[model samples]
Target: MRRHGWRWVLIGVLGLLVTGCFAPSGPRFGDGSAVPEEVSRVRLPVRPGPDGTWVVNSPGEGLLGQGRVLVRRAGPDRRGWRLALPAEFALTSQRPGSAHSAFVGDHSVVLVGGREGRRGPSEIAGLDLTNGRLAWRLRVAPDSRVFSYDEGATVLVADCRAGSCRLTGVSYPTGRRVWSRTAPGAVKVLDGCRADAFVADPVVGRAPCHPYLVTRDRVSLLDMADGRLYERPGLRIPPGGIDRITENHGRITLATAPAKGSCRATVVSESGGDGAQDLGWRYTFVWDQPQAPRDPATGCRWDRTLPLTVVRSLVLPDAEGALVLDPYLGLRKQLRRLAPGEYLTADETRVEVVHASGRPDRPLHPTRTPLRPPGLSPAARFLTRLLWQDGRRLVLLDHQNRPLWEAASACRAFMGDGEGPGVSLTYCDGPDLVTVRPAWKD
Candidate 1:
C-alpha cells in the first residue's frame, strides 16, 4: 500500500508540473466601472439584429437590427442613420445554411421575413444598404426560407410541405428571378460555391467553389451561375435524421441524433426569447473523400455542444472552454474558457463568442498548448493577432501572443457578419446597439 501511494503521489506532482508550465495565465482586467481609453465604443438606439448571426465586415457600417434598421459607423457624436423597418414586419433570424436574414450583397441588401405571426407567405425584399430604399419585393411561398446568397445569386428554398420543395434563385440588385429547381422531399443547401456570405471577409483568401443541394437520399452540387444541379455520388447522408452539418478545410461533417428515444433531439430557447428555438445534438460523420462519409463517432450529449471551427479544426464545447477533436473525434486539446456557455465560433485569425437571444457570451481560446492540425506535428495552430470579446472583456492580442490591450467591455455579445479582426462587432446593451472599435497605434 505504501509503494502504490508513493507512485500515485509522483504522478500527481508530474501532472501539476506539466499544467503549471504551460497553462495560459494572464491578467483579468475590469471592474465594470470604467471603459478604457484604447477601446472605442459607439452606441446606437436600436435592438440588435437577429440572435445568433451577428457578423460585421466593414468599418463604415456598424449595427443592424431585427427591426430592419441599419446604423452606419458612428463618429464622435453617436449620430447615425436609422432605416426603420415596416410596422410589425420583423426581420427573420439566421437559419441553417443562411448566414443572416438581411443578406448584404454587393449591390443590395436582401431582407427576408414577413409579419410576425400571421404567417401565410413571407416577403423577400431588396433594399439599398445605404439609403434603405425598397428596390423590389417578392412574396414567396408560405414555407419560404432563405437558404444562402452567393455572389449575385440569393437562393430561397420553399414549398417544403409533404415532401417536395422548390429552389428559387433571385438576383441581388434587380430582384429578378434567375433560375429555379424543384426537388423531392425536404432539401438542404450546402455552400459548394465560392461565396462570401458565410465567411468573415469577402475579399481576403476567399476562393470559389460549387454549391450543393442535399436531400435525404442523395447530394447534388449546384452551379452558381445558373440553377443547374450536378449530382455527386461520392458523399451520402448516413441513416437517421440529420441534426447539423458543418464544412471546413474542404471536408463536410454531418451530425445525426436519435429521433425517438430518451436522447432524442430537443428544441430549447438559447436566448430565452420568444419564438426562437435552437436545436441542441449526437453523432458526427466527417467526409472528405469522393466517397461516402466515415463511420460516425457516437456519443449522447444533452447540453448545447454545437460544432465550432477553430484553426480549421472541429471544436466542441467542454466545461473549461472547448475541445479540439481530430478527424476521428479524438481529444486533441482543451481550450480556455473565454466566455460563458458553449456558444463560440471562429475563423482563420480570430475567435469570438456567439450569442442568441441575449444570452451570456462564452469565451473560446486555447489554454495549455498550441493545437496543430490532424497528422501535422511541427506546425501549430496560432492566434497570432486578434481582437476578440469574451462576455464583458475586449482583448487585443498582438503577434507575439501577448495582450496588446485588455479593457472592460460592454460587448455582451458580438454581432459580426463573419470572423477576423476587420469584422465589425455590433451588440445590444440594454436598449442601445453598441459597436466596438479598438484604437490600435499601428
Candidate 2:
C-alpha cells in the first residue's frame, strides 16, 4: 500500500509541473478568461535623481491650481532642467478665476496672468522651481493670453491686442529676454515648426464670425539664435476657412471648413517651400461629424456618421497622428481609426459599475473615472475607475483608478503588484511612474 501511494504522488507532481509550464498564471476575474492585471504604479528611475524619484503636485486653489502639470528632469543629467506646464491652459470647468496656464521648464515655471493682487497687465512670469522664486516677468497686454510653449527653443506665443501679437523667447537661467517679435495682426500661435512658428490671423469680427475670411496669416520660421523671421508668406486657401490646425512630426495639418458645411483636412510639410510645393496631400471628409482619421497617412473618415453624443474626446496618438475616439456617455466602445488605409481596430471596451456618492442600489456613473487600481470585489468595483489605454497598452485599474496590470501589444501583460499569470512578470516596468499615491478602498 505504501508503494502504490508513492507512485500516485509522483504522477500528481508531474501533471502539476506540465500544467504550470503550458498554462501560465494570470489574474482571473469572475469571467473565466484571464483578464490582464492592473498596473498599480510605474516607477521609471531613468531620470537620475536621489534614487530617481519624482513627485506630482497641483496648486491648492484657482485656475493655476487646477491645471494638472508634470515636472521631471529635462535631460538624463541629475541637475538638468525640468518642465512643468503642458501646451493647453484651458480649465475643464468654468471656475471663478483664471485657470492653470503655465509649463515649468528648466529653471522656470511660466505663469499666464499677473500675481494675485498686483494690478497690472497679463504677464508671463518665469518662476524658479528650485526655490519658488520669480526669475523674470514679461508684461503682456492685458488683452493677451499666453497659450502655447515651444520646447525646441523655450519660446512662448501669446495673443495680444491692437492687431499685434508677441512671440518671446527667454533664457532659462537668468530669465533674460532672448528675443521678441510683434506680428502684423492679432495672430494666435497655432503650432510650432522646426525653428518656425505658425500663427492664425483671426478675422476682425464678433463672437460667431468666419475664421477663413481673415486670411493672409503667415507661417514664419524664426532663427532660434537671433529670432529673425526666415519665411513669411501668405497661404491661400479655397473659399472656405481653416477650422483647426494640428501639428505632428514638424508637419501642420489644416482642417478646413467647407463653404456650406463639413470640413476637409490637408497635410502640409513644414520643411518644404512656403508656396504650393509645401502642400503634401489633401483629404476631404464626407460626413459633418468630428471624426479623426485612424492612421496618419490615410487621414480621417468623414463618411461614417456616429451618433454625436456617443463620442467624448478625440486623441491623436503621438507623431503618427492616429486618432483614438474616447466615448464617454455610451456603451463602452473605444475605437481607433488608422490613417492611410482607414482601417478600424477594436480592443476591449466594457463599462463596469462604479460607486461614488449614491447607494449600491442606484450608483452614479461619472463621465470621468476616478484614479484607482483593479480587481476589486463586486462591491469594490463600484468605486473603481476603469483603466483605458496607456500608450499602446490596455490596462485595468482598481476602484481608485490605480493600475493593477496592463496588457501590451495584445500580449505580454505587466502587473504592478507583481501578481499575475505571464512569462514577463516584472514590477515597475509599466507606464513610466512619476509618483505613487495611497490606494483608496471602495
Candidate 3:
C-alpha cells in the first residue's frame, strides 16, 4: 500500500487532465509525400472535418461568419479544401461549470451549464455540427449535471433542487423535458459497470449503512429513453454493509464484504421488458491485502459461499489503476493479447489495451473483437483512446493514470470523435480550437 500511495495521488491529479492535446508530429501526412507542414497554431476557430481535415475559419463576433469570414477544411488529402460552415460558430462557451458537453447523434453538439451560485449554465444549448446553426436550448435547474448522451442528440441530467435530485431526460434542439423522476441522491454511472438507466438508490442524508434495505426506499430503474421509470429486482442489503453500488453498460452491482476481509458483490442484469430481475450473479474475493486494495498480488478466489451465473471477470489492479479478469487462471481471455505486466480496463463491451510501460497501447492497425464482449443495460460503445473532451479540455491520462500533457490555453471548447487510434478530437483556447488526430511517435 505504501509503494502504491503515489499512484493514487497521481490519479487524482490526472483526473483533471483527462482531455489533452498533441504537438503535431511535424510534416507528416496521411499521403505518401511529405510536403510543407500546415500550421496548427492559429488565431482562428477550428474544428475537425470529415475525411481527415481540420476546419478553420476567420473570427466573428460570437460565431463564424460567411461573408466577412471564410471557412475551409484543410488537409494534405488535396481534395481541395471544402467550404466550412457559412453561419456563425464558436466553441467558446459562456455557461458555467465546465460547460457540460455532448454530441447529439452525429450532426449536432450540445453544451449545458447549471451549477448553482457558480457560473450558471443559463441554458442547455445544442448546435448543428455541420452548419453551426443553433439547434435548441433548454432552461435547466441551477444545479443540473449532464452525465451521458444518447445515439441521437439527447442528454440525461441530474437536476438537484431544494434537497432532492431528479433524473430528467431532455431532448436537444427542442429543450423539452420528456421525462423526469426524483433521483435517490448523487448516484453516478461508471464507465464499465454498464447500467443503462437503472440506478441504485444512493441514499443521502442517512447513515452510511444500507438505507434502501432498512427504509425500504424503492429500488428502481429508469429507462434512458423519453419513456418511463420502473421499480424492479427489489434487492436486499447483505450482512456486513454495502461498500457501494455501481453500474456500467447494463450491469448493476451491489458490493459488500460479508466476512472480515472478503469482497462480496451482487451483480444484477436489467430485466427484459418484464419486471423480472432477469439474471443475478454473485462473486467474492479474499484479497491478500484488503487494506491496500487494488493490489496485483491480491489473488481472487470466488467465495462460492453464494451462487452466481454467467461469471465474467475479477477486477485486479496493475501498476497504474486496475484491470478486469476472468475467474480462471492467468488473466481474462479478453486480456490475453496484452503483454506481460500490461493492463486493461473492461467496461461495457470494450477493452482498453495497456502496455507494460503503463501507457495506452495503440496498435498500428485497429483492434476489433472484444475478448469477452458482454451485453449491457447502459453505456455506449466508445473508441480505445486514453483521453477525451470534458467541456473545453481534453480529459486524458497516461498508462499510469497520469496526465498525458497539459493544455497551453484556458480551453473554451473541446470535442473528441471516434475511439482508439482512430479517435480524433478538437478543443478551444478561446476561439482557437485545435484538432488532434490519434497518432504516436514510434
Candidate 4:
C-alpha cells in the first residue's frame, strides 16, 4: 500500500489523469451523439508509423481473435489499405482447453492459428506486415510472450509458458529453430498475438548475467553468453513463504504475509554482498489495512543497490510525479522503500538524497532522468482511475511521462506502445477515433 502527501496517480489507457473540473468551454466532442457507424467500428489504433503511415488492428481491441490489421496511410484523409487477414485466415479463440491470443511486432504479427481439436498444442503463425504474407508458423506447448534481440531488430523471443520451458531462439525470416537451451522453469514472456513485446531488460555484464526468468518455484537468471544460469550459493527462497521475489545486483527483497505479523519485507543479499545480513523489517500495510496501491519499496526490489550507510527508513518524495512499479522491477516512480532509512527522491528540478536519520549524502542521481523504469503498478492503476469521465469534454491527465500517451474509458481504450517514441495519444468519442500528437512537452 502507499502513503503520500505526494501520492502517485495512474489512469485509463495511455494512463492519463484528467483532474480538476474543466470549463464547459474546454475543447470537447461537439455533441453527446456518437459518430457515424463507420467511425465507431472496432479498430485498435497502434503507435503511428513514420511518414504519415499508421497501423491499426481491428474487431475491437482484445487478446482474442476476430479482426484484421488495418493499415492506414495518410491520403487526402487517413484511409485503410491492405487488410492483413482475410476470410481464409479469420481467427477465433474457441478452443476446448487453450485460450487464443496474439502479439504484434515491428515487421511481423503473430497469433494463435486455428486449431482442429479441443486438446492439443498451441499453434502460432507470424505474418509479414509488408506483404500480409505468412512469415512463419510454429507451435508452443501452451502460451507465449514475445521478446526481441534488440531495438529495431526483427528477431523475436517467444517466452513460452511450458513450465520448465527452455529458450529457443528462432530466425526471424525463417521460423527454423536456431538456438535452444534449458533454463529452470517456463519462460514467462509478456504479451499475446496483437501487441508487440520486447526484451524489458537486456542481459548485462561482460558475460551477460541476465535474460530474467521466473520458475514455478523461484525466479531464475539466464546467462546468454554461455546459456548457463547464475547460481546463488547463499540464497534460498523458503518454500511457500514469500509472495514475490525481486533481484537487483545480486540482492533479493522478499514480499510476504506472515500468519501473525503484518505484511513485511526482508532484504537479503544473494551474493553475500551484505554478508547475508537482514537489511531490516519494513511493514507494507499502513494502519494494518492494506493500502490500495502497494508502494514498491514495500513489495518489490528496485534496480538500484541500497547504499550501506543508509541502513533504515529511506524516504524518497515523489515531488508530484507518478511511479509505475513492475512486479519484478519495483516502482516506475522508484521510491522503492520508504521511511526508516536514507533514500533518494526527485522532482521537475532536482533529485535529492533524503535520510531518515539526518540530511544529504550528496545527490546520487540527478533529476529529469529517473534511475529506474517508470512502471504501472496494478494497484496504482486500479486506485488512481477512480473517476475518469466528467460530463462531455474528455481530457487525459498529463502525468508528463515520456514513454506513454494513450487513453481509455468505458467507451474506448487505446493501448500504449513504448516500443518506439513519438507517442500519438488516440482516444475515442463514440464512433470517432481522435489522434493527439506530441504526447508530452513543455
Candidate 5:
C-alpha cells in the first residue's frame, strides 16, 4: 500500500513539473502587457517569405538540411498551413525583397542554395506547397544569382566575371535548361525594375517576364524566354557612379553619392579646429530622352547614403534636408526643419515623420477627435490603420496613434497593405512567424 501511494505521489509531482514547463507564464505582448482578445499570435522559427502571406525557416548549415515553412491568410478564421522541408536537401532564401527571401509561386516555394557541404554545384529546390514534397532540383553555376522566378520560369545572371555576365533561364518544375546569353560588360541587375515593365506576358504567364540589367556603360533589358537583348540607347549613363536606380512612369532615376574618401577638412572658426566628413550627391536620368542626366544638388552633405526607394517616391537624405522626387521622377520638394528624432518618409500623397519611438509624429489621415485620449470608444464609427516599428516590435496603430495590436519580429520588416481592410502584416519573430490583422474599422 505504501509503495502504491508513493508511486501516485511521484506521478502527480511529475505532472505538475510538465504543466509548469508548458503553461503560459504571463502574456505574449512585450513588457508583460496583456494581449487583447482580438490579437492573434503563433510561434515558429522563421524568416519572412516572398510575400506577406507566408514565412519560411532559415536553413541549417550544409548542402542537405531541413527546416519549416508556413503560409498564413487573413480573415475572421485566420486559416493557414505549415510544412517541414524535406530532409533530402537544404535550401535558403536570398536577396529578399520587402520581407521575402524565397519566391512563393502559384504552386511551389522555390529556394536557392550555395555549395556548402560535399555538394559541388550551386542549386535551387522547388518544394510543393500543397503536400510539402520536393518536386524538383536544378544544379546551376556556382556564381549564378537568381534575379526573378515564378511558377512558369526562373531567370538568373550567371558567370559574372572577367568583365561580363551571362543571362540564363530555366524551365519550371522540370529543372530543364532553356536558354543563355552572353553580355559584353559587367552586368548589375536593378532589383525592382522588371524587363517586362509591369505587364504580364501572355506566354510567360505570371513569372517575372524578364530582368533589367545595367552595366558600366548602358541599361539593357533581357528576354527571359530566349535570352534576347533589347539595348536602349536613349538611356544614357550619367557621370558619378550610379549607386541606386529606380523606375517610375517610364523614367529611370539613378542616385549618386560622393566618391569614397573625398572628404575635405572644414575649419571651425570659433574653436580653431578642423574636421572632415564625407559628402553626398544626387543624380537623375531619363529613359527615352536624349539629354544627359540632371544633377540638381551639389554640396558637402554627409557620408554616402543609399536612396530610400519606394513605389512612387525616391528620397535622398542630406545633412540639411531631404530631397523628394515627384511621381514623374522630377524634384518635388526639399523637406526642411526636421526634428532631431524624426525620420522622413514620402509616399504618393505626403511627407510624414516617423518618430524615434516608431510611431508617426501625427495622424496619417484626418482624425475624428484629434485631441481626445486614444482607445476605442462606443461612439467611434471609423478607424485608420498604420504600422509602427518600435525596435524589433511591430505596433499596429489607428489614425489617432493608438496601438491596437503589437508583435515582435526577427527581421524587423513588414509586408502587405496596411490601409486595406483585409491585408495582414506578416513577419518573423525569432522562432515564431506572426501575422496580425489591423482593425481598420470601428
Candidate 6:
C-alpha cells in the first residue's frame, strides 16, 4: 500500500507540472468604463466607376469582395495578384472595375484588365504594388476563374462554359500552358487540400452539348503540382442537390442526404480504394424536429410534427478524433470517438452529455441555457470564432474577433491600428502593427 501511494503521488505531481506548463492564462476584457482611443483613417485611392464598391479588407490579413477568394500577401514586402474575369465571364452579377482587381493584402489598389460587361477573349494584366508598373499579362478565355497562385511560377485556371469545363495549369511568367485536362461535363471545384484540388462533375450519360458533356457527377482529385488527374467514383446525388464536403488530415468527409431521405456522412481516406468500400461510419439524428424554436420560451411550434433529420456540426482536430456538437433535447452533447473508417456506424457510441442550466417549464423561454460547461464565459463564446488551438492552450481573442490577446500571457495584449473612429486599446504585449482603415460613423 505504501509503495502504491508513493507511485500515485509521483504521478499526480508530474501531471500537475505538465498542466502548469500548458495552462492558458485567463482572458482579459476591456473595461466598459473608458472610451476606447480612436483609430487613424486613411483615404484609399478611389477607383474609376464606383466610389466605395472597390473592396474592403476583413478583420484578418485578407480581402473580401465577391466570393471566398480572399487573397492575402505572403509577406509585408510581397504582393499577390488575382485576375478577375469580366461580368460576361461571370455566371452572376458584375461589380464595375472590380471585374478585374488584384487583392493586394488590405490595400485593393491593383487593377487587372477586364471590362464590366465585356465578353469572349480577355487578356490578364496586373498592376504592380511595389513600383506601380504592369506586372504580367496572359491571354485567357472569358469564362475562366483564377483558382490559385504560387508567386510567379504557375496559376490554375478553371474555364467553364455551358455544361462543359476545362482545367488548365498555366505558367505565369511565360504565359505558356503547362498542362490541361478537359472534363466531360460541368465541374465544380470543391476544395483544395495539400497539393491537390478536388473537383466534382454532376452530369453523366450521353449529352450532346459540348466537348465534355458525357462526364458529369463524377469526383476527381487533381494534382496541383502537375495537373495530373485521378478520377474517383461517381457521386449520384439528385439533380440540384448539394453536399457539404471538407478535407482534413488527408481524409475527405462528405455529408449528404441518403436516397432513403435521411442525412448521412461518409469519410474517405486519401488512400485509393473502392468507392463504396471507403464509406466511413454513418450517423442519424433521432430528433423528431431538428430546427430550434425562434423563441426558446415557446416550445417547438409543432410537437406532433415528424422529427427533422440533420447532420450535427462536427469539428475534427488533427489529433483529437471527431467532436460532434448535438444541439438537441435542450442540451448540447459532444461525441468523441476514434477516427471513423469506412463501414462504421454510430451505434452504442459513448457520448459526453453537456446539460443546460435550468429546466424548460414554460412553452418557450427567453434564454436557452448553454449545453456546454460554464468554463467558457459569454465573452469567450462570442470570441470563439477567433479561438484557435496553439499547442495546448487556446489563443483567445477580443470582442471584435481580432486576435488581440493570446491567453499565454496575462498582462500583455496586442493592439492593432489606432487612427480613425475605430476603437483601439493599448496592450502590454509586443509592438503593434498599425493599419489604416476608412472612418466609420457611429
Per-model CA lDDT versus the true structure: 0.46, 0.36, 0.38, 0.36, 0.44, 0.36
Q: Which residue segments of model 5 deviate by more than 4 Å?
A: 1-83, 86-94, 97-100, 115-121, 149-152, 193-210, 263-307, 310-312, 327-329, 332-342, 346-351, 354-442
Worst 10 residues of 6 by lDDT: 341-350
Where does model 4 exceed 4 Å of error? 1-99, 104-121, 142-165, 183-219, 223-226, 241-245, 248-250, 254-392, 396-425, 436-442
Cα TM-score of candidate 2: 0.40
Q: Write the per-residue lDDT of candidate 1 for residues 1-442, one digit (tens) a residue.
A: 9999999999999999999999954322222122223234445445443332333223334445554454455455435566666653345444322322565544446666556554533677776665546778777776555544434465554455556667778776678888886877656565432221223322334433445666887656566557777664444466664454444443444544433332333111121123321221233322121111222443333322233344344444433334445422322233333232334454333444343234532334434433322222221123222444544454555444455655443434443432443334444444455544333243
Residue-level lDDT for 67 in candidate 4:
40
TM-score of 3: 0.40
Clashes of each: 20, 41, 35, 32, 3, 23
User: What is the TM-score of candidate 4?
Assistant: 0.42
TM-score of each predicted structure versus truth: 0.54, 0.40, 0.40, 0.42, 0.54, 0.41
Residue 326's C-alpha lDDT in candidate 5?
46
For candidate 4, give the lDDT of residue 49.
27
Question: Per-residue lDDT of 26-142 in model 3, one digit per residue for the tens?
Answer: 322122222212135446533333312222222111222222132334434312122232122222332122343223233334554333355534456665544544566666665
**Model 6: per-residue Cα lDDT over 147-180, one tens digit each:** 4332334556667766667887765444567888
Error of 1 at 293 (Å): 28
RMSD of 1: 17.2
